[model samples]
Target chain A: MSDDVAKFLDADIPDPTDFPADAPGLRQLDEALRCTMCRELFEAPVTVNCPHGHCFCSMCIRTALATKDECPLCRHAIREVHLRRNTAVEDAVRAWGLARTFVLQVLREKEEAKAATVASKYFSGKPKSKKRRRTPELSSDDEVVEVGERNVSHSLKGHTSSSSSGVVPCPICNKSVPMQNINNHIDQGCPSPKDADLDVLLSPSSKSKGKQKQEWSKLFQGGGAGSATTGSKKGKGKSRGADQDADPLPKIAYDTVTQKRLREILEELDLPTTGDRATMSARHSRWVNMFNANLDASPSQRKSVKQLMLELRRWEEAEEKKKTRAKLDAKDFDSGQYQKDNKTTFARLVEAAKPKAPKKSQSPHEGPPASSLSPSDGDSIAPPRRTEVVTIED
Target chain B: MFEAGPVSEADFFTWEALIMGPKDTPFEGGVFAARLTFPADYPLSPFKMKFDPPLFHPNVYADGTVCISILHTPGDDPTMYEAASERWSPVQSVEKVLLSVISMLAEPNLESGANIDCCKLYRDNKAEYERIVREGIKAQLGL
Candidate 1:
């Protein structure tokens, strides 16, 4: 195989470029809804309580604050407590989420229609001059029809019911099929009209929406149980009663906490206390950040405790690997220089170890070996010679 | 413009970069080959960058590690010379590091010199220092 590295980009992810070049306004609109830190469309977006009032994904801001108690964009002094739900932005994001796939499909159709029109004009035996003049008028009309209110209402109608000639994504396969043909398409096991782009755009979103609803309902139940603790616990005690409240977890003073106390805390959270004191403290702090961040998210968007725990474990594993790699690198970096720096200590250690072997043998049988050393100085010039029977013969 | 990507598809932790030396400096016209090794906890912790063949500059160590305040973490002020505000934070990225290093090449920070010989030559004999740097680049290019 060629030595050239594989070039890849996350081209599938919805980005500002999803809007065509002509729609710079729409592109900017798409960009405005994204979190700067994660560079993804905002999920559970929160406005930083600063003069700048910058918005970020709830998890993004919480993770940033955990590292440094300031805004990532403006460096304004901030804390997790300062974050407030930006419901206006949330609604905007939600509306955009539903509109995004529809817009993309419509845009794609419009482009195809333009291209087909252009091709027919070029290839057909029509007068070139006459065709050129008519093409502009035709294009302008198409733009007004496709991009204006008429197309949106038509698509919405098709989305709800497959009666009109307007296109709707097939429920089973998610391809943009003509509204009238959706039932036939599914009846034939979604065989044809293989529009992969629309499928890719629409299917994931529908799936995520379902998953999100399930998680929201689960969280809602847990929250309800938490509120009615006395009654709910009697029915089902599975609810994560510890973290259902709205209050943020108090920050742990990692430096002051004993290892035993930290391990106990980890155990209470059902977390692995496998790493050292420092690791345990770091893990606990990270868990707190994640837990509090989940609380910040809208109840419908909050992840389950099990999901959060899995994320924590994954993060810790990655971090632990990095730490071990760094340690190994430090040991391997300029080995000769490292040896030189510790040469004296190494020499002292060797010297300390030399006398211990002789003392171990002599201590079991010989009493007051120090006193015997002066009397046997005539033959005790070498310590090994004095312990010859044990050293070699024995 | 500087360009960088992973050296191999299997290993994202290490990246190879081609940085154009800042214009109007001794290092101008030199296309430096540098390696960026990112820790697993990247963006949270800054990556380590080094010139492969090593650059002869005061702020660059003989081993080619860049000695700039922006690359150093807040907890890593061994010399106690850099201010906390100037040090690396989560907000810093590879692009910022690249820009800082380019500026560093244009004007070396003598306060925290990495190469004592280069620093001394730069301070005591500016003409000789630039001449040596140019000659070194010429030798590297086999010109």
Candidate 2:
């Protein structure tokens, strides 16, 4: 069931390694890479010429420009057009995204190796020669090649060698035994081990690998993912035999296109066409982003258009709801401006509410009697008057 | 992490920061320590910045609380002095606030003086005001 959903939804390849997301080094890297404005990984990063040298994603700066012309960091006057795209930062973010997976894999392997060593020490009755040879080799390689190709190759060699000895490591207990006896070892020999480890080692990879191979074959037939899918679908289902790649879809001239035609085009693409022209345009842009983002994903995880459309619709609804809520909240309260403008009326209400002050003091001839009152009395009376006014206004 | 100021957190909600006064200002060469108390709904509401051993500045009240437009709520201004855009917004972080405070020290807004006496002195006798401010900085430093 999930396989079908995965086909339509751009699924991220779940990291095969056991690296924790919150590992301190990874967290620090995440923070460093995050845009100052959106607090997310930089997308089309741009640096503003502020004194403080703050950088924000392009979208964030555009949004900030709508309200304030000043830099968010230093309040120095900055125009959106003046923002220079930080190619260096953009490259850094791209490199980090690709490197993150490899780094996590290496770290998880190192951690597992350490755990295996500790377990070997605890279970000392096992053949000491195998343990001694493996420990020094693993530790030396770990220290020498902490983050390069050498470490991965070394680990791969270690796995092959252990397998060659008619012994496959019981993944659960990290114990080496014959491949034929591995299942029996796990069932009877190893103490109650984490079931998750077994599942991780066994299931998802085999299923995902098959799906990946199918995707690769599809890619080769189609030429490019985007053009191929659109061409095949648009060819009235008869051009399946055409070995040549189709031309890319013509860009829709939204301004020139009639609303009816636009809606029809959207319908053809299996996209939602329920909203107004602006919303439709927004939906279309979001669809393009989803489509392009899916194409950018590893071949195995590329999503179908139908799934991308569904995602776009969900996102649009969420954004619409958030905007409506903010509008309602802003409209509900005037933030004490009303009280400040109507101070006299509030003072009168306060005087009226007070336990019938002497008529002589409250007389119209007293000429704004608040000034005549003692400073202490005036201070005591002012706050309640403002609060009372606010309540009445509400 | 600041070079001009070192910030130490008492907790997530409370922080103490020592700011070195900006160069070529009356406040230059002084290390002013202030406490920033973040409300539970911080970023939504601005943090309260209070200088320890209050500095006599037009924007700082006698009680040591610094009054700046950036520290005001991102709502309709009751005083009508600051635009809503100039007031606090969630996008404004703690680093921005500290930089703003330092800038505020260099260029005091005498129009809305929280310290009335300092405002009057600053307006009437610029030299005397500078001398007095220098003395205040010296006293804080025990010079």
Per-residue alpha-carbon lDDT of candidate 1 for residues A1-394, written as tens digits (9 for 90 to 100) = 1122222222243667779879658888888987776666777789997789999888777777767777776767887787898878876875676577778877776666556555654577465446456567666566555555555566667656654758876543345888777567644545533334323322334333344333333333343443454352222112345444556667888888888999777655555567689878888888887777777655544555655654565465456545666776775678887899999999999999987766345433311223322221111010011111111111
After best superposition, candidate 2 residue B109: deviation in angstroms? 0.8
Q: Native-contact recovery for every candidate? A: 0.10, 0.03
Interface root-mean-square deviation, each candidate: 31.6, 21.7
**Per-model C-alpha lDDT, please?**
0.65, 0.57
* Best of the candidates, TM-score: 1
Clashing pairs in 2: none
> Please, what is the TM-score per model?
0.63, 0.36
State the DockQ of every prediction. Answer: 0.17, 0.09
